[model samples]
Target: MSKIDEYIAKRSKQSADFAREYKEESQKLQVAVEVRNLREELGMSQRKFAELVGKPQSTIARIESGKMNVSINVLNEIAVATNQKLTVRFEPVTA
Candidate 1:
């Protein structure tokens, strides 16, 4: 692994709290990337995407920046607005 990845893995093994927070932050980052990608694919600016999704531009900005804990209801609204399907599933964790 790379140096940063190695460090994170070592620290995660050493501290349960760090591991939990890391997982949470990783999930948030995944969501942020997906949302940003979707907006780009739709050729919409943040303001335009927010208008389409019935949210404020600031909300979109926060979500894209991984600073917002987005709700499923809002995600569903975004999906409907973008004419895309949103799917959620549970996966087994691997070490």
Candidate 2:
């Protein structure tokens, strides 16, 4: 592995709490990126997207900023608003 990859792997194995927190935060950031990308692709601002999703602008801001725990209901609302379906799956994490 590369140096950074090796270091992260070693740290993750040595610190269980750090590994869990890192995984959680990574997932949150990934979702936030996807949300922002979709909104941008649709040429919509956060305010317009929030209105379409029936959520407050602050809620969208929080979600997009990765500062909020997203719920399935909210995700579903966003999907419907964007004419997409929310699909979730589980897969093995590659090191």
Among these predicted structures, which one has the highest lDDT? 1
**How accurate locally, in lDDT, is each candidate?**
0.95, 0.88
Q: Write the per-residue lDDT of candidate 1 for residues 9-95, one digit (tens) a residue.
A: 999999999999999999889999999999999999999999999999999999999998888999999999999999999999876
Q: Cα deviation of 19 in candidate 2 (Å)? A: 0.5
For model 2, which pairs clash? Answer: none
Q: List per-candidate RMSD values in Å.
A: 0.8, 1.3
lDDT by residue (tens digit), candidate 2, 1-95: 89978877888999998889888888888888888888899999999988888999998898889988788888888999899979998999998
What overall lDDT, based on C-alpha atoms, would model 2 receive against the true structure? 0.88
TM-score of each: 0.95, 0.91
